[model samples]
Target: MAGVHVVANQKGGVGKTTVTVNLAAVVADTLGGTADSSPVLGVSTDPQASMLEWAERAGNELPFDFEQCHDNPKLLGKLREIKQYSHIFVDTPGSLENESILQAVLTQADDVIVPLEPEPLSFNPATRSIERVIQPAGVPWRVLLNNWDPRDGTADLEQTREYIAAKRWPAFNTVIRHYKLHTRAPADGVTVVQYAKNRVALEARQDFFRLALEVLGTGGDGPRHASAVNGVSSTNGG
Candidate 1:
């Protein structure tokens, strides 16, 4: 069985699909996946199927296996039965109308990653999803600050951190900073690892690499997986 990590939030435009693909890609790279064997799998439960489309656009260049399981409860429920992949990252729908799909995925999730923007308006919807769906599922979850721009100063970032801390929510220390590269990735059919080798591209890829380490329990404070990779046993809890 693979560790199922669902990237979910009830609000739109929080970079759920972006985080799902990139995180899976970097983790697969760290695991040294080859052309014939991909250790990571990316699944999309959004009716929009953004992740699936991104994989299609990427052609055969994606580092991990990809699947679209939207409206398919049977597939979502059977995720744990698949043993080939070490990790499975799921991109879920952000709309309330498709919440049942989110619920179905959560039932099999070993961990959940909630992406939240640094804005007051996003707080309520993020909290609603955490409290309503995630909490009930009893899965370990952490909030990730996405689309943060250092140029805009740290006021918004600081305030968002304060909000999460006030609510006693677990969060990642890593912030997925805003970058035009990430915005253009879907249309360009590229992941951070596939970006042109430049300063900005290196920075973009590094962020996800650090995030992947945290998810694998090799770095930072985040949930650990039961599996071993590269002789490292990620067995500790966050």
Candidate 2:
């Protein structure tokens, strides 16, 4: 059974799609199997279909298999038939009003990655989502501090981290800082690994790489696959 990781949160605008796409890229680019026989599958369950658009924009630039499954709740049942895949990354809806969709995705996911912004407003909803949905599903989860401003040494970042720690939530050590290169990806149809010329781009790439490592470590497995490449096979959601 391939590891199923879902990017979900009750609160919107937390960069769920961004994390979903990039982590899938890192896994497909650097981990298991060859790029030609891509191992990672990017599953988009969000009603907005942002991931679908992103895949179209990326074209051959994407490093993993991409799919849009509007019927996300059925994804879990179908995944069992796809044991060949090494990783499955699902991008889910973030609206509090979309609890049913989030619940469905969570029910099927083996793991969840909750990306939280560095703000007070982002914390409560995430915590509630984790407590009400994630814990009940018994799926292991980790929170990543996204959109962090390293220059702003105010208490926001620290307080948020402390809050997570206080609640005994698992989180990643790699903090994804806000960078222009990251913001430019969706617009430019580029992944961090493809942004080879810019230092900040390379830095962003490294963060995702670290995140991939952390995720893979959860299963105590390494990137054991074919030669690394730069492209992935694209597919539609089932």
Candidate 3:
């Protein structure tokens, strides 16, 4: 069976869909997937169907398979049964009211990637989702620092890391910096790998490539001692 990775967070606007699609794309590319036979699959359980829309906009250019299974717990739970794909990346609903949808996908998650913006307000809800939903599921999960701007210096980034450490939460060493290319991706129907070959685009794709290596267990040291808190070992990546 394929490894099922669900990108989830209870709070909205954390780049869950962006993480799902791009991570899947980079992993698929790394694995040498083709349009005809993709090793990766991207599934969206969000009512907004953002992933599906993005895929449609990209037309036949996406490197992996894509699907939207909104409000369908049975389909979501059965994803692990699919054997063709090496990995299945799921984009889930963002609101607490969609707890049922989130719960359904978590049932199949081998690992969960929770994208967190480095801001004070995003802290509580992220912790809430981890404590109430992800931790209870007992899956090895990590908090990914997304949308961080290095131009703003490392204070906010360092503070976010401190918060995660104080709570003993697992996290990726890979911080996905803020890039206008990422914001323009969905509208342009492109993934990081499909971005124009410019320095900025290269940097954008490199982040996800490093992240994909980590997710595939081929990069970086594993996450901090998060096993002590959740009793599940966390994996690290570059």
Candidate 4:
């Protein structure tokens, strides 16, 4: 089977869209060359459509094009019907109530990446979202830390880590540093690969590649049963 990875969190401004778009680009680069690579299909479900906008600004020349699914109740069924593509990346809305669309996607999804800001508020939503949608629908997920600053040991990083540890949740070990480059990332409308080789973007790219490997799984035959979508999917094949 094919994989569907949702970049979402109940809370807003956790860099959901940024992660979605860039992650898609990284996946493309990692697996795009070989015909056997599992292709990634990026779906923009958020009302704001930040990922969609980035796709537009980056021009239609990307390895994979981002599709706007409109968050209709029919979304999941619509996606599953097309199995030619290999993977799916969905950028969901920020509000918790958006579960209607999120849950529908998750029902068919294999995994999700919940971006947390290393704070209690960011930490809280993963559990709630899982309880409400992930567990209910039987989907797997990983919490990814974003905008991390180790300086705030007492309030941000440590607290969130302990909370996640207590809950026994899966989280990415790579931490995205808080940098002006990352803040300006979306405006540039490209993944770290497309940017200048600064230290910050370089690290971000490596971390994202780690996430891509996690998505693609070990030994990279790349997820089985690639989706039936129209184009060559964006994949992170080994």
RMSD of each: 4.8, 8.2, 2.3, 7.1
Q: Compared with the true structure, what per-residue lDDT tens digits does model 1 show for residues 96-197?
A: 999899988988888888999998989999999998898788777778999898889999999999998788777777889999999999999988889999
lDDT of the candidates, in the order given = 0.85, 0.76, 0.88, 0.68
TM-score against native, each model: 0.93, 0.86, 0.94, 0.82
Which has the greatest lDDT? Answer: 3
- Angstrom error of the Cα, residue 130, model 2: value is 0.8
How does candidate 2 score on lDDT? 0.76
- Candidate 1 deviant stretches above 4 angstroms: 224-238
User: Where in model 2 is the C-alpha error above 4 Å?
Assistant: 32-36, 218-238
In model 2, residue pairs whose N, Cα or C atoms come closer than 3 Å (at least 3 residues apart or on different chains), thus clashing, are 33-225, 33-226, 68-237
C-alpha displacement of 118 in model 2, angstroms?
Answer: 1.3
Q: Order the candidates by TM-score, highest first — what do you get?
A: 3, 1, 2, 4
Q: Estimate the overall C-alpha local distance difference test score of candidate 4.
A: 0.68
| TM-score of decoy 1 | 0.93
**Residue-level error in angstroms, candidate 3, position 22:** 0.5
Worst 10 residues of 4 by lDDT: 221-230
- The positional error of residue 238 in candidate 3, measured at the CA in angstroms, is 16
lDDT of 4 by residue, 49-157 (tens): 7777777777645556568875566766566566756767788888876667787777666667788888776666667776676656655566778878655554677
Question: How well does model 3 score by local distance difference test?
Answer: 0.88
